[model samples]
Target: MTVKTTLSFTDRHHRFLTDKVGQGVFASQSAAVAAALEQMIRDEEERELTLGAMADEIRARLDTPRADYVPGENAFATARARLQAAREA
Candidate 1:
């Protein structure tokens, strides 16, 4: 089920879409708009999922005991040394 709606674009945006359609990038203006809207929906969904995962990770970390934590700098130093060794090899 698809909903039909009218959209107004700025002159610049209209020209950009027109040029894209002229170049055979899309079958029609509707196709170009539909493609862009689809991409936007996907991007927003991904952003939401990422934020949810980050929130879950933060909550899990907050529940962990501070005594079990290692200094971040120590981890970074270890990773940096590994990269240097890899480069030398």
Candidate 2:
């Protein structure tokens, strides 16, 4: 399969990519970019999945109220102190 597009690259990056391709590391500049873009897409998909899982966890936390909050202590400081204490223990 073959694809073509008018893609732009900065001078420095262009030189760098071209050099790698010229060294026989890649069959062509397009091949190098396509390989990089394929990896980027895979990474982005993984990131999106991880973020979605985190968002779900956050929503669950929001629905569950903690009974440990002490009066007069700000939420952040209390949470940080509890977490640090747990880590030290």
Candidate 3:
């Protein structure tokens, strides 16, 4: 089911939508708006997921004992060398 509602856009945004529809990117203004909104939703969800993962990593690192951890300099160099090897492969 779809709900119909009125939305207002600035002149520039309206023109951009109109041009996209005219160029056959979308069949109508509604389609263009829907596509834009869907992409925005996807992007925001991805951002939230990324931030959540980063928080989990930080928490895990903080919980680890200092004795169990490697030095930052050695860890960074090892990671960089691995990445370079992967790219070359």
TM-score (C-alpha, index-matched) for candidate 1: 0.82
Backbone clash tally (model 1): 0
After superposition on all CA atoms, what RMSD does each candidate show versus the true structure? 2.1, 5.1, 3.6
Give the top-scoring candidate (TM-score). 1
Q: Least lDDT summed over 10 consecutive residues: which range in candidate 2? A: 66-75
Off by over 4 Å in 3: 78-89
Order of all candidates by lDDT, from best down to worst?
3, 1, 2
State which candidate, 2 or 3, has the greater TM-score: 3
Residue-by-residue lDDT tens digits, candidate 3, 17-62? 9999999999999999899899999999999999999999999989
Whole-model alpha-carbon lDDT for candidate 3: 0.95
Q: TM-score order of candidates, best first?
A: 1, 3, 2
Candidate 2: deviation at residue 38, Å?
Answer: 0.9
> Least lDDT summed over 10 consecutive residues: which range in candidate 3?
70-79
| Best by the lDDT measure | 3
lDDT of 1 by residue, 19-89 (tens): 99999999988899999999999999999999999999999999999898978888689789999999999
